[model samples]
Target: MKKQLTAIFISLLFFQLSISAVEPMKPQEFKADIIIYGGTSAAITAAVQATRMKKTVIIVSPDRHLGGLSASGLGFTDTGNKGVIGGLAREFYHRVYLHYQDKQSWPWQQQTEYGNKGQGTPAIDGTDRTMWIFEPHVAEQIMEDFVKENTLKIYRDELLNRESGVLMKNGNILAITTLSGKKFIGKVFIDTTYEGDLMAAAKVSYHVGREANTTYGENWNGVQTLVFQHQHHFATKIDPYKIPGDKKSGLLAGISNETPSPNGTADDKLQAYCFRMCLTNVPENRVAFPKPDRYNLLDYELLVRVFNSGWKALFNKYDPLPNRKTDTNNHGPFSTDYIGMNYDYPEASYQRRKEIIAAHENYQKGLMYFMATDPRIPKDLQQQLNTWGLAKDEFKDNGNWPHQIYVREARRMIGAFVMSENEVLGKKEVPKPIGMGSYSLDSHHTQRYVTPEGYVQNEGDIGVKAPKPYGISYNAIVPKITECKNLLVPICISSSHIAYGSVRMEPVFMILGESAATAASLAIDNRTAVQEVNYNQLKTLLLKQKQTLNWNGKP
Candidate 1:
């Protein structure tokens, strides 16, 4: 039997070789004018736009899934105005509208039961251009439609070539490789990831942490202890000390390695990351949380303590989208924001990243289990947790857990120009307006701490309202002309920490994605590098393509 199996393996290898020989290497093996390196909403739209302009484009997706946050559990888009979102971004919503047309599409809801009358939502044919509401599966189906319609080539689960792979000649990218050793070559590259990995690997300058207010002379750029919008946590100042006003209780778990400076000097600390889970009453798609390897009970002791402390808003953060489903998020202090644990995640290798992901899953799942099953948990909170389960219809592969965590912030590229708080507040004028972000200058929980007075405290969670719709410059998307002549438009936006808070929404990503593709196509057409592409020509093309270059600018 062993000899027979070995012979079969040998035959399979020979068959694969035969197939490879038939497909001989062309001079530009799988060459595209634009090669995007993500499966994000922004990446897909960018590639689709390039394709629309008759440019051959391919997406080398590191993730197994497509449509990063948009297809993930972020269904309730944080878009300020539907008018501000246009181009392929609006088309994506239109596709979502199309998905709900068929009765079979409603696996969770009957078509007749699901009403079509929408306010300000664009239907497939622009009949009901109202609020865009969809389930995870619906979004995925629509994203699949976009790809099929455009005939875009996508290589899924392909890890990128970080070290010696990106072959560059005179500031132009020739080709990039995957860890499995697949090559994807293209002309203009779009770095549409939340983490900006490809851009960093290509030796682009980027930043990981917050900058001081002094660095940019901006008001919002600092380690502010001020609780502005949601002042629920800081009703009273709590102390970090263990002995209640004593000097030495040490610190709680997950505090930063760096000293806490008030000036917000560039520390590696970032806002929290959590899996935006989709939950339902269905059981078949829900997988129980196994007792994870390296599962530590001490990691969840704090959560148990929080439950005992009378915090029972487990579902408080759930944002409803469509089909009677929810896009659930982290609610309160120490809920789902794996605080201070993902510091090394942005730059870690795949193996290390997986380990961290497991740890996070274990932490979050163990917290839920501890709350639901542990006798120490408050009776009411435990009862509430027992009422919830993973949604059957979503993430059929990963037990309905979101594939991409809501990585609120990561390595923001320090490009030709940094979009600081000044740009968002109209203090500094954006030279070339590619897109506008109108979402509140919002930030998720940043740190969990033991106060000096012996109580738990969560700091740096901000929800500042934007004064008005703000303009984002194209300069933030490109590296310094000296660093690389090519454009690396981050769908997650490129800015200082505070500025990124507003620019990090899914709709903003779509907007930025469309603009990036327009610029890429224009650069290719003009026979110039992205850095040298005339802004005036790019602007003309963007307006012609139905992008919102001119904002409504209303508060």
Candidate 2:
């Protein structure tokens, strides 16, 4: 008994000592051939492709989950055409397929009886391919497997020091200091954040809002009052005013009440933002939405008003992923979108980012809690919502809440090539194809405004189908031929804002990520800048990797 007590006491002491030994954000240095800054689908693709090329790679992500939205709960991929998906990105969905081969994976669907709805490049449910729609944790597990098999090094929760921290020497990044003061050294770097935080820190030129239509000769660019997509049209077509016909009631919670005049003028505003909530009806895996501490009922006054306006189609955008869970997102006006509220997020600091996150959480939680329990909602809609809850098996951390919020649109870098509407609509072909996108140019719920009659209306949610599988440009991944010369990119970093609207699909990002990795490796081998890398050589390499080139390339 005495010996056991001594052992237990010594164990406790060791545990405490080990815990104390962890220095508070030490500036440790490490070397790698490539240093990827995010756990996004593109980042993973880059890292995996680099490993295949025998280049040492590491992913330094501030978050623990990998594959960004792909792994974070966006299993219902927003791909426009599956034909454009290929290489590592397609392989990912194949792995997702393998996971479902086991009967145990289908807790809701009967094994061998479930209908397969496979489409796109990987055909999410094809016999030889893995399914695309997946739970958050399953995506994480796949990423972990990829990392483990390739011996890819990943440092989780390593935050970037947004200012004066990432040290670039002679046009090439030498070292980056994280917020915790850890230093990471690499030959080449890729910025994969939805916010482009690291790229901005590196002094890359980027735009934050929709450009006026004249900026890129883009017909669909800027001030798109005439072409709203999706289904978030305001019910009353309210005018942006405060007093109704009297024009005296202060403008509602949203609306840049005054429309900006410059056709292509840039602004510090973006589309909409929402948490990709993971929900389930399985009793064993359901977690009730927790009403946050600062739950202001008044913040949702517009939503309450919206509900009262008879717009109670609650299941409009509850998109399902794998594992009987859903990547439930915002739909019509007054839905889950936090419009006109995230204008400052692109350039905000950590504390500021947290503030926005908290505010969004409050807005979303209150919205859900309202839908499920609010007395004002229609009886049938409320009853339907009551059947849903956060999936117990997904996002096991953070109370099953999705770790990623859809940024929709943010800072887009003007790179070696800027993709425009012409390239997207195939009015003209993009010169160098590195990737493809097929999702309709989809943005979601931006605002609510007061009408001429004192009623409210919604705006900004758009969803336009493209003509075909449009090729994404390789130059979109690199800084201007005159700007930083050693970088390669894929995470919605290149292209004009409207062009990015269609190019920002997850499968496309993964394809671009693989292509970016290929370019980065080639640049390293040839001792040349990313902009100077031979396109023909890059194209050949991509073709070898099963990437569809020229759109007409054979499968």
Q: Each model's RMSD to truth, in Å? A: 4.9, 4.9
Off by over 4 Å in 1: 1-28, 101-128, 226-228, 231-252, 255-259, 282-294, 553-555
lDDT of each: 0.72, 0.75
Q: Where does candidate 1 have its weakest 10-residue lDDT segment?
A: 116-125
lDDT of 2: 0.75
Which stretches of candidate 2 lie above 4 Å from their native place?
Answer: 1-26, 112-114, 117-124, 237-266, 451-455, 553-555
Enumerate clash totals for all models, in the order shown.
15, 21
- Number of the top-ranking candidate, with TM-score as the measure: 2
Model 2 — which ten-residue stretch has the worst lDDT? Answer: 114-123
